[model samples]
Target: MNKKRMLVSLVTGAILGVFCIVGASIRSGGEASTSLLFALWYNRIIMGLVIGLNISKKDLPSIIIRGAFLGLVVSFAYYASTGFTDIVSFLAGIIYGIIIEYVNFRVNK
Candidate 1:
């Protein structure tokens, strides 16, 4: 695995995780449970790890697809855990995945 890619992805995850928390708080009007918030944050972290560890084709198209796929798969866990009620977050996960991979590609290139 590429350490640079991993590091970039992880950092991206951590940053996005914070954003996820903020978004959740706003969406729930600060009424979201702590556990739910934590899960949402951790979900992004896991997504990052998965994306970072993924050793796939280096081309841009391949990277974007892989990122989207990984994000969708990883985010599904959290989405499923919530009984599929948070469609917004589930969709955001796919976007975040693409962002993470695109950032990694740019930074590591």
Candidate 2:
């Protein structure tokens, strides 16, 4: 990826990481587990990387397909690592991909 794209991914991942931390803290009543926090950061970073790498200045359909596929791959890896299946996470991944792509599109433009 280009330097600009990398920078965008990093920034987006960091923003998502912060959101994950805050969400986890709230969900756990301000006592989130270290592992949970770590997972959140890791997942967001992966998603950002995948979205940044796959998306391009292309047609909307192609962009959507690429983003959705990459998102599924990342989400699958996460679920496999944790030895659990979460429908929410799976769906979230897809949504995250679209959101990331949209953000990149807006930023790049």
Candidate 3:
């Protein structure tokens, strides 16, 4: 949680966001781009690793429960972005959240 680490994470995350947007847009026609895959993969893997590393061993169950809720929240969070243009994207968030959270829980345990 140091300022330097936080800054690095923030910058990386923003960059990834850009890649996601670009990748998803171009995805309308062709096979998915490597850059887009890299962005999403990096975010999920690293973020999950970070969360797993920080979770308390004894509170694993509670932590997992919270993570589940977070996934649900993320699904809901996409409503604004996909509400008008792509309901599938919003629905995918729910699945993404679950998969990401499950991986985090497994790694952390």
| Candidate that scores best on lDDT | 1
Model 3, residue 11: distance off in Å is 14
Q: Evaluate residue 7 in candidate 3 and report its C-alpha lDDT on the 0 to 100 scale.
A: 41
Residue-level lDDT tens digits of model 1 in 1-109: 9898888899999899999999999999999999999999999999999999977456999988988999999999999999999999999999999999999888877
- What's the lDDT for residue 104 in model 1? 89
Candidate 2, residues 5-58: lDDT per residue as tens digits? 767866786686677667767767888678877886789788887676653665
RMSD for all candidates, in order, please: 1.0, 2.3, 7.0
The candidate, 2 or 3, that scores higher on TM-score is 2
Candidate 3: misplaced stretches above 4 Å? 1-27, 30-69
* Colliding residue pairs in candidate 1: none
TM-score between model 3 and native: 0.42
Q: After superposition, how far is residue 20 of candidate 1 from its true place, in Å?
A: 0.7
TM-score of 2: 0.77
- Ranked by TM-score, the better of candidates 1 and 2 is 1
The runs of at least 3 residues in candidate 2 whose Cα sits more than 4 Å from the true structure, single-residue gaps closed, are 25-32
**Which 10 successive residues of model 2 have the least lDDT summed?**
81-90
lDDT of 3 by residue, 1-40 (tens): 3343334334443444454555566665656566644544
How high is the lDDT of residue 15 in model 2? 81
lDDT, each prediction: 0.92, 0.71, 0.46
